[model samples]
Structures are given as structure tokens and as C-alpha cells.
Target chain A: MSIRYAILGFLSANPLSGYDLKKLFEESSVFHWSGNNNQVYRTLVELHNEGLVTQEVQQQADYPARKIYTITEKGLAELRQWVLSEPELPQIKSSFLVQLAWADQLEADALDDLLRKYDAEIHDQLIVVQEHKRRSKTSPQRTPREAYLWEAIMDNKILYYETELNWVRTVRETLNEMGKDK
Target chain B: MSIRYAILGFLSANPLSGYDLKKLFEESSVFHWSGNNNQVYRTLVELHNEGLVTQEVQQQADYPARKIYTITEKGLAELRQWVLSEPELPQIKSSFLVQLAWADQLEADALDDLLRKYDAEIHDQLIVVQEHKRRSKTSPQRTPREAYLWEAIMDNKILYYETELNWVRTVRETLNEMGKDK
Candidate 1:
């Protein structure tokens, strides 16, 4: 449902082909909010079926024709309604945390190894988020208000990763201290 | 898959009826990693069918017969294997964040309203997490190591909510300032 609205929200901005939507999602750092290619295409079809969105096929010279999607007025209204509605609590499902929950059964070395591996993964994610932030800032053509909102979203993403990295470090340090006592 | 391992981990500790598992999930702060009653029962059946767990029917005098689920040796092995495996990146899906991403389309007051509503939601979640932490600490019978791991998990959850609440406040403040400027 959120994915449906996310697509509608993007289409409300401009008509876009599936490829264009995917590119926009990646470029705008909305990929996290989007489904994979198949899911996106399927949702577009569903939206068209529901009259929430309309599609037009564009002829190409040599390449295959592209089906462009445009959000209908109903879709725009639904997106706005969703945006104003009570926010659903995001389902938390951290597999890393799940491992940590049961880590007491693991040996200290193994646990330390797990933490370090997770730390590295988070570090990489932090880098990706940083890059996204940079791209968001340098991208031109947005209204000041739009840029402000985009920055706020990017800032939130950046801080989320930074917080995770810090937590990982704290846990690692604790594990190290525990290792010394054993 | 994470839910399966979480259930297996709990069952490895002790046999539990679906009701017991659901209660423990809420009490132990593993609810985020678990599903609802239907999912729990269905997964238990799946596990039983897969020979990873076995169910024993206990006839109750006043209530319906309870099916107590016990993890098989295979289940324990699988749980351990999963815990030791590389952790998958948790997918991020915050409807609040999604709304914020497109919030430039909304009026200042509407955006402010949205942020305030989200803030209240996070506040409620923070209270739930804190209560879960207190219960985790007060509950007895865990070994020192088990307690340590539990504390770490609780700490992660607490910090996550705290960070989110702080971020929400920051966003609201910025929104207010934007409103003032406008």
C-alpha cells in the first residue's frame, strides 16, 4: 500500500516510463521506498487497472516502445490522503539485531567476529548514504522548498546510518571488554 | 526466515504453546521480530511439517487442548546456523519519512500537522520500548551472559526510538522555522 502511494506520489510530479521511474527512484534516494523492477511494473499495472493511473505507449525509432505512466486526479487525491493520514509504524526487522538477541549462545570470538562484520556492512551503507546526500545537494532545478524537504529526508537517512555505526562501535567495545574478563 | 529463527531460538530455550510464544514475544520485546497469532500458529505448523519442530497436544481441563511446540535438534542446528550467517540489510520503510519526502507539495500547516502526529506516535512507541526494557531487567532466571545479550538488544531498541524521537523533534523545529519564514 505504501509502495502504491509512493509510486503515485512520484507520478504526481511528472509522467514517467518504468525505466524513468526506476532512475528517478535511484537518483532521488527514494529507492529504499520503492519496490524492485518487477514489483514496480506490477504495481503500475494494478494502478492502471484501478483507474488511479493511466499509461501511454511511446513509439521509438529503433528501440522498443516505452509505456509511460501518469497519475490520475484520483491517484493524486489518494496520495495526498495517504500523506495526511496517520502514519503506520514501520515494521522493524533487523536481522543483525536478531543475531545479537541470540548471541549469548555464541562464543566470544564468534560474537566479536559477527559485530565486526556488521560494523563493516554499516560503514559501507553510511558511505552510500553520504553519497546520496551529496548528490541530493548538488542536483539543481528544485524549488527551495523542495530542496529543503529533500535535504531533510537525506539528513534523516544519514543520521540513521551514523547512529547505527556508533551503536555498532559501542557494542564492539563492550564485547572487547567482555572478552578481557573471560 | 528471521521470524522462523526467532521462534526456533525461543523454542530452543523451552517448549511453548502458540499462546505462550505470543505472550513471550510481547513480554520479551521480540514482538518486532515475530508475527501475530495467525502467523505464529501457521509457522509452527510449517515447522512441524518440515520436521524442524514437533508439537505435543496437552489436554486442558477447562480450556481447549494446547499444542506445545518444541524445537528439534535440527531446529536448534538451523537456528544456530542462521544466527552465525551473514546478516541481511534490514529494509527501511517509514511512511512518515515517505510523507516527508514529498511534503513540499503540502501546505506548511499540513506538513506541521503531519510532523506533530508522527511525533506523538514515536513518543508512544518510545514508552512501549522503555517498558519492555524495564520488564526485561526485572524478569529473573537468565544467566549472566543471557542477561547481557538481552540488555544489548534492549539498548539497541531503546536507542533507535530515542534517535527517531529526537530526529522528529528536529524536523518539526525546522518545519516551524520554515513556516515562520514563509
Candidate 2:
């Protein structure tokens, strides 16, 4: 459902084909569609079927026709409703957390190995997001508020990753203390 | 599959019925099963069929028979492997971020209202997690390392929430500055 709303949000910005939508999501620092690439196409189909979005097929000389999607009046209304609706609190479902909940059985060395690997992955992710932030520029066409909201999304992601990296450091220090006490 | 491991992790501590497992998940600050649930029971069934867990039906007078599940040697091995395995990086998929991407259309008052409501939820959730941390107790039977790992898990959650709450504050301030600029 959230994906549906996101698609509508994108269409509201500009008329885009599924291919263009895929490109937008790929370059997005905020929302990356996970799993199959077809989710975008699937969601677009649903939106079109519901009459929230209209499709206009553009014929090409040397390529297959592309269906361009535009947000309808109903789509814009639905997106507006979703924007002001109370959002769901981000759920706590980190598998790593679930692992730590029972990792008392893991040998100290093994546990440290796991934490180090996890930390490295997070560190790499942080760098990727930082690079994305460095490349982001507000289009002159966007209002100041829209640009700020975009930056806010990026900041939310970056801050959480930074906190995770720092927590990993603390956990490792705790591990070292436990080793010394033994 | 991760929930399957979590259930196995719990069973490794002690045998538990499906009912007991549900209670454990509900009380868990580390992992909360979302949606219609029954995930625990479904996972237990899968584990039992896979020979990773064994169940004993305990019949009682004035009560329905309850099936108690214990992690088999296979389940224990699987859990240990998962503990040492590399963890997947957390995905960035906040619906609020998606909403914000298109929320430039929102009236200034409506946007502020949405931000305030979201902030309150994050604030309340942080308090709930902090209270859970305050009430947590380490069992005497747990080794020092085990206890610290438990604390690390709690610290991980608390720190992330703190970061999120702080991010929300900064976002609201950004909104206010935009208002001033206008």
C-alpha cells in the first residue's frame, strides 16, 4: 500500500513510464524498491486499474511503445490523504538484534567476528549514503519546502546509520571488558 | 526465515509451547512479529517438520492439550550458524519518508500538524523502550558476557530511537525556518 502511494507520489511530480519510474527509484536516496523489479510495474497496473492513474502509450519508431503514467485527480487526492495520515512507527525487526538476543551461546571470538563483519557492512552503507548526499542537488523548479523535505529524508537515514555504527563500537568495547574480566 | 531462527533461539534457552512463544515475542523488545501473527506457530510447524525441533503434547484435565517445542540438536546447530553469519544491513524503507517526498503540496499548517503527530509517536515509543530497559533484569545463571550482550541489544534499540527522535526535532526546525523564509 505504501508502495502504491509512493508510485502515485512520483507520478504527481511528472508523467513517467514504468521504465522512468524504475530509474527514479534506483537513484532515490529515500526509497529503494526491494526484491523483484516488477513491483513498480505491478503497482502501476493497480493504480491504472483503480482509475487513480491514467496511461498514455507513446509510440516509438525503433522501439516498443511505452506507456506513460500520469497521476489523475483522484490519485493526487489519495496521495494528499496519505501524506497527512498518521504514519506507522517503524517496526523493530532487525535480524541482527534477534541474533544477539540468543547469542549468549556464541563463543567470544565467534561473536566478535560477527560484530566486526556487521560493523563493516554498516560502515560501507554509511559511506554510500554519504556519497549520495554529496551528489544531491535541489532542482530550481522545486519549492524550498520540497527541497528541505528531501534533505530531511536523507538526514534521517544518515543519522540512524551513524547511531548504529557508534553502538557497534560500544558493544565491542563491552566485549573487550568481558574478556579482561575472565 | 529470520523469525524461524528467533523462535529457535528462544527454544534453545528452554522448551516452550506455541502459546508461550507468542508471549515471549509480545514481551520482546528485540523483535516484534508484525501483521496477523500466527508466524510463530507457522514457523514452529516448519521447524518440527524439518527435524530441527521436536514437540511433546502435554495433556491436562480441564484444559486443551498443549504442544511444547524444544530445539533439537539440528536447531541448535542452525541457530549457532546464524549467530556467527554475516548480518544483513537494515533497509531504508520508512513510509513517512515516502510521504514526505510528495508532501510539498501540503498546506503549511497541515504539514506542521503531521510533523507534530509523528513526533509524538516517536517520543512515546522511546519512552516505552526506556521503561523496558529500566525494568530488565539479568538472570543469575547468565554469564557476564551473556548479560552484556543483552544490554547491548537494549542499547542498540534505545540509541536508534534517540537518534530518530532527534532527527524529527531537526526536521521540525527546518520546517519552521522554511516558514520564516516565506
Candidate 3:
């Protein structure tokens, strides 16, 4: 799956312990993809079983020994193959949309309240995304190419939220019009 | 989950046999939500266990006996509760974005090819969505309110694909520019 390839891609960049991968995944933009500690460890085990990654335990002076993972040559090859392969269609399951689909079941006033609440939620999200974009833009650590791709991802996220906000406003306006007519 | 409520929503509209539910699910816009027969049946059993639904065997003259499911009062209450509750945040796991995140690993040509292929795929999907919209508009069985909600869902789908198509084109252009400067 894409998670496996995401792991391989991270490993391809540099060697990382399971704990390190978990931290990086959580702290980075990759958090949007949402991999948890258990998933990270389980995926590492699977990748090791597949001979795509190797693990070595490093003993520390005072801390507990930790296992470090490195991508093998096969891992790199597989990662490249995955990058160039056909991307899987995104699986979208929007609970908001589901509610909207059945919105007619609710009274006009109740539906108006629902849309207003959802609109506020999306507005908060848009602020977060915009802040992330601002931070990413100023970060000197990113290579020009990396920055370009990162911006692309951020732009995608921004556009998505904006589109949703626009839809919410339009739906709210239409609902208001319907109410007035009645 | 949402699927349970989706089933309840449909049953709230009308009593349906298991086979009827399966057919309706597959043939309707609800297919975007992605439920299978096994899941439908399993959820039905769960709903029955919860006293949210009841089933009766209806004998057909030409066909085998079928179990028809009807939403109980509890089921209707649950469905309305779900419709009014805070919607879950949409979980997005886009393989294309995953690929883009690691795209620097691939050669420029390979990345270019990937974008082109993705663009073509989105174009094909837009055609399908547009066709569905046209058919839904002409369906006379929908009430004015139902038609409005359905149109909102269709508009959401159309906007999403359009946004994706635009992103694909922009990314491809940026990649092309990156290639020329190199």
C-alpha cells in the first residue's frame, strides 16, 4: 500500500529508527497522511520481512538500545518503481457530504445551523493550513525542488479548504433563499 | 459508523430487501461512499441486534423468499441523530500526493510522465461525473428538496475533479519549467 511506499521513501532519504520515523511522520506535513506509532512499527516489521529494509540495534550509554532502519538497494529500487507507477485513486469518504446528502431530512432552521457550524469548522482549518504554508515558505532547509513540491501540496490543501468554504456559503445562501420563499 | 447510518437513511425512506439494498447502493450516487453486499448484510444484522431495525421474510411467487428490512422508530431516531451530529473530518489518503512528496527521487521525465498520466485519468473521471449529473437532473422521482440536496452532492463532485485537474496541469507546467532550467 501507499503507507509502505511512504515508509520506504522516508528511509530512502536517510537512516531512521522506528521511534525517529514516528516522530518525523508526526511532526512533518506527512501528519496529514496520519500514520500512528503502531502503524509505523508494524510497517517497519513488514518491510523488513519483505527484505526491503534492514534493522540494526544500537546500544546507548545510558538509554535503552534502539533499532535503526535502513533502506536496502532493493528498497530504493522498489521506492523508485512506486514513485513512477500509476498512483491509486484517492478514496474519499466525507462524513460532511453524507450529512449534506441527507440534509433534507432536517428542518430548514436545523439545516441552517448545521451549515453554519460546518462553515466555522472549515474556516478554522483554512487558518491552520495558511499558517503552515507561511512557515514552509520561509524555511531555509528545503531545497528549491523540495520547496516546489511542498508548495504544491500546500496549495492543494489550501485550494481544497477554500473550495469547501465556497460551497458552504453557496449552500447556505440557497437555503436562506428557500426559507424566504416559504 | 457512517455506513450504518447510510443504511438506516435508506431504510427510513422505504423497506428494502437485502438484495434490493445491494442493488440500490450500487446503482445510486451512494456508490461514492463504497459499501459492499457483505458489509451491508453485516451492518443489517448489527442493526437488527441493536433493535434499530426489524426484518420479515416475504415469499415471492416466482423468486425465493427474501428478508425485507424496515427501520424501527429507534432506527429513525438514530439516523436523525447522526445527520445532526458533528461530522467527522474527512480522511484523505491521496496516493498521488504521496508520490508527489517523494517525486524528487524520480527523474524529471518519469515525473512528467506520471503527471500526464494522472491528468488523463482525472479527465476521464470528469466525463463520468458530468454524465451522472446530466442523468440526475432529468430524474423525475426526486422531490424539490431531494433534488436540491442531490444537486449539491453532484456539484461537490464536479468541483473536486475540476480542482484536481487544475492542480495536475499546474504541477506539470512547473515540472516542465524545472526541466528547462536544468
Candidate 4:
């Protein structure tokens, strides 16, 4: 699915400006997605032309007038149709796999540094997931199901990061034995 | 990193034909990577032209004589430099997440099925992790550090999958209350 669909889906729930959609995406599902700001604005224009969403211009004194988009009935129908359809398998292109693939040709020290950096990244993400979980526990708007689902997703993320950190430590230890520090 | 490096890295280990390289990738660290035959063959030709790899035609009885490639010293140096360099952050673009981001648009039943499928996939992966852990226990060629690292990776996979499965179940239960069935 394209980011266009995501924008439309968000608008389906309530009217939102392009800026609002961007903010919602980052706050709600930042871990699973990333989008170029240009791409989001571009998709919004295309979605408007396609008649899936309509824009209302609101005047503001302190800022520029904003275009707020709401999903049309046709758009809601399309979203439902898209959901019933089977999704294509996502392409997995991971840099970690590439680095490891060529590890045999790499210097011992280089491999150690890569592992160390990777370890740090996982640790940082673990912290983010933990903080997200703690915050969700107190949010009043969250239904019981949404609360539980959010916690499960964050917990899974924490466990995954912890696993990566543990794995990197082991890789670093192996590099030390091979004389990486030297 | 590009698939070009992955192919070159494998040749740096030992001279191997396209078929052999494919098999090695499947069994090696590159197993986590997905490379089609066209990409592998194209990368091999590019490497040969760039003088990063040397190819030789070898005669075989049952199959056609294949061109095997071995990495040149220059290729090894390049791979080494890459390993020492900072790794790019891992970026993912998942259609599954895109679908979930617009989940409000889905029919309750459709959304329920999606959750169920995701849950099943995570469960299946957890089984694979457990099997890997079991195999690592019996392998003697594996160093102590290697065993620990591999196990840590496996444990993380298990945990992540379980966490995802739990999220799916919670989503499904919520959808069920909305009259969605799996």
C-alpha cells in the first residue's frame, strides 16, 4: 500500500490538514513507517484529484490558510475494498544482512565497530519503546483493546532491541578474541 | 549496501560459480537477504567488468560449464573499508504497516483476518527460532561467543514474534466485539 492510502485512511476517521496527517503518522505509527514530507504533500494532491478526498480552505489570522481533507463515501468504499484484497509481501532489504554477508573480507576492528554501533542503536530503540508503553498506559482516549495492542507492539519492540544488543555483545567479544582492539 | 557487495563478498571467501554462490548465500549470513537470480547474475557481471572479481570458465559433466568468480585484492579492500565505515540506519517500507495505519477503513472481518494471518506468521517464526537454538546447542564448530550471539538473536526473534502475535490477538478480540469474525 502507498502512503496515499494511509493519508486517505486517516482522513476517513476525521478531517485533517496535510500537516495534521504528518503529525498523526509520526505520533501513532512512527516505528513502522517513515515518509518524506514532499511525498505526503504530493500524495495528498493526487488523492484530491482522484475524488477520494475533498479539501476545505480555512482562513487564519496568525498563520496561512490551511486545507483540511475529509474522505468521501467513495473513498471509504475503496478503503474497505483494499482491505479485503490480499496484500503483497513487502520487499526486505536490510543493511545488517549485507554487512554480515561480507564479514569474511572485513578487518576485525571494523566488524567490532559496526557491532558496537548496532548495539547502541538497539539500546536507544529499547528506551523509546519503554517510554511509549509507559505513556500509553495513562492516555484516556485509548480503548482497552488499543491500549493492550499498543503495549504488545512496544513490548515486542523492546524484546527485539534487547536481542540485538545481546547478539552484538557476543559479536564484539568474538572480535576481541580475534585481536580487534590491537 | 547493494547486492553487488553481497555477491563480491561471497566470492572473496572462495571462488564459486553462480549456482554455488546462490547456495552459499542461502546457507550463510546472507540467508536473511533476498536475492533473485537476475540480480545475482547481473552483479557478478558488473564485478567482473570492474576488475573487482575474476571469472573463469570451468567444465562440468552433467551441467553446462559455468563461469566461477573469485574476488581480487581490490575487492577485498573495498569490502574491508565498508565494514569499518558507519552503517546506514535500517529503513523499512512495509505494506502491512500501511494497511494497519488505515485500519479504520477495513471491514471488521477483513481486519480480523489480517490480524490472524500476522499472528500465524509470528508463531511460525518463533518455531524457527527455537529450532535454531536447538541446533546451535549441538554444533561443535561454533565458538562459545558465536553460540551465545546466535542464541541471543534467536531469542530476540522469538520474543518479537510472540509480542506481535499478542498484538494481533488483542486487535482481533476488539474487532470481534464489532461483529468481525476470523
Model 4 B-chain TM: 0.74
After superposition, which runs of candidate 2 have C-alpha atoms over 4 Å from their true positions? A137-141, B35-37, B137-141
Predicted candidate 1 versus true structure: per-residue lDDT over B17-105, tens digit per residue: 99987776766554464437887888898999999999899999999999999999898888888889997666666777777766777
How far in Å is the alpha carbon of A41 misplaced in model 2? 1.5
Candidate 1 C-alpha lDDT tens digits along A106-146: 88889889988988988898898788787664233257777
Q: Write the per-residue lDDT of candidate 4 for residues B1-182, one digit (tens) a residue.
A: 67676666556656888887666555432245444677778888888888888989999999899998888998887777775666654554456655654554455566678777777766776676577666653222234444444454445445555655665676677668646323
DockQ of each: 0.64, 0.72, 0.67, 0.30
lDDT tens digits by residue: candidate 3, B28-137: 65345544778889989999999999999999899899999999999999889999998655666678887887888677888888889989988887888788888873
- Give the Å shift of residue A18 in candidate 2: 0.9
Query: Which parts of model 3 are misplaced by more than 4 Å?
Result: A28-33, A137-143, B28-31, B137-142
**CAPRI quality band, candidate 1:** medium
- The residue-by-residue lDDT of candidate 4 on A1-182, one tens digit each, is 56766676667667889888777667653335454578778888888899998989999999999999889988887876776666444333557645654554445566677777877876777787678777763222234444444454455456555656675676678668757434
Name the lDDT value of residue B150 in candidate 1.
75
Query: Which candidate ranks first by DockQ, i.e. highest?
Result: 2
State which candidate, 1 or 2, has the greater TM-score.
2
The Cα RMSD in angstroms, rounded to one decimal, for candidate 4 relative to the true structure is: 5.2
Error of 4 at B42 (Å): 3.3
TM-score of chain B of 2: 0.91
Alpha-carbon error at A97 in model 4, in Å? 4.0
Cα displacement (Å) at residue B32, model 2: 2.9
User: What TM-score, over all chains together, does every model reach?
Assistant: 0.92, 0.94, 0.92, 0.73
